[model samples]
Target: PTLTAGTVKGNTAGAFGYKNTITTDNSYVVGSNSTISADNGMVLGNSATVTGANGLALGNNTKVANDNAVAIGNGSETAAAG
Candidate 1:
């Protein structure tokens, strides 16, 4: 399944606020308002953003904007630009 149980926003519009699906194969987004826009991306906390493939965001309001990037802790962001 694309989404398992207890997903606050799964396969439903207006929860993620983006055209892309909330979670794709090899991708995992596990928080309210988090986003993953590419493959192999992971968003682990609330309000996180991952715009690049193989990116990871792991806290509230964190952002990973480039490919093969990782952001850990709260509000962490990758310096690389997409």
Candidate 2:
């Protein structure tokens, strides 16, 4: 489903020219051409990406670690002690 724009308290839209399929709880994100797979993570920018749980992300063209990691910023990333 194409979740459009809104200050929705629960659901949000996908990035521009993209699709939003993953579902999560307690997270925030914005912008286009980005990705995330966090259960309680957040992002607010363009071309950002992540594929982990309980993580948070921000900035443009960024990547995150998997398995309970937190990523932040473009070309800036990190991983947790898992």
Candidate 3:
């Protein structure tokens, strides 16, 4: 069961944009081409991605790739877990 406005798949996750996808429980994705693939992850900008549990990515092309990490600002990326 997912709440979606675009391409999405997850148990109780939400995705709301073109090509957005959430693939883990309690995750959320928004903006075009964004993706969230871990539990409690969230992405909220174009091309943003979150690939670790409890991670967050916010801004264009931002990425969070470790557990409890957060990436903010355009083109930002996390280099280590939080």
Candidate 4:
């Protein structure tokens, strides 16, 4: 994966997008129809998209931002874990 290009299309374990992803890239899309672009990020969607270094989109249209983060479902943002 480059600064924005990682796909994990639909399957079973995950309705779409990436469910159990792990790595250090830029962007990552894990859905049947989604897009990602970031640095060390992840996205999981059915038809979503993401744009940015270290971002992620996960869902039908999720989106993410920042590095070492992750988005789940269509669009979103990786909030600091507690």
**Candidates by TM-score, descending order:** 3, 1, 2, 4
lDDT for predicted candidate 3 compared with the true structure: 0.82
User: Model 4: per-residue lDDT, tens digit, 9-52?
Assistant: 32321223333333334334454555543344455555554455
lDDT of 4: 0.45
- In the range 1-82, model 1's lDDT, one tens digit per residue, is 2343323333332223222235534676666667776677777778887887889888889988888999999989998753
Write down the RMSD of candidate 4 (Cα, Å). Answer: 8.6
Across 1-82, the per-residue lDDT of candidate 2 in tens digits comes to 2345423233552332343334555555666555656666566666666667666666777767665666665777766675
Q: Please give the ranking of all candidate structures by lDDT, highest first, separated by commas.
A: 3, 1, 2, 4
TM-score list, all predictions: 0.68, 0.58, 0.85, 0.41
Report the candidate with higher lDDT, 2 versus 3.
Answer: 3
Candidate 1 global lDDT: 0.67
Off by over 4 Å in 2: 1-22
Considering summed lDDT, which 10 consecutive residues are worst modelled in model 1? 11-20
Pairs with steric clashes in candidate 2: none
> How does residue 67 of candidate 3 score in lDDT?
91
**Whole-model alpha-carbon lDDT for candidate 2:** 0.57
CA lDDT of each prediction against the hidden true structure: 0.67, 0.57, 0.82, 0.45
Candidate with the greatest TM-score versus the true structure: 3
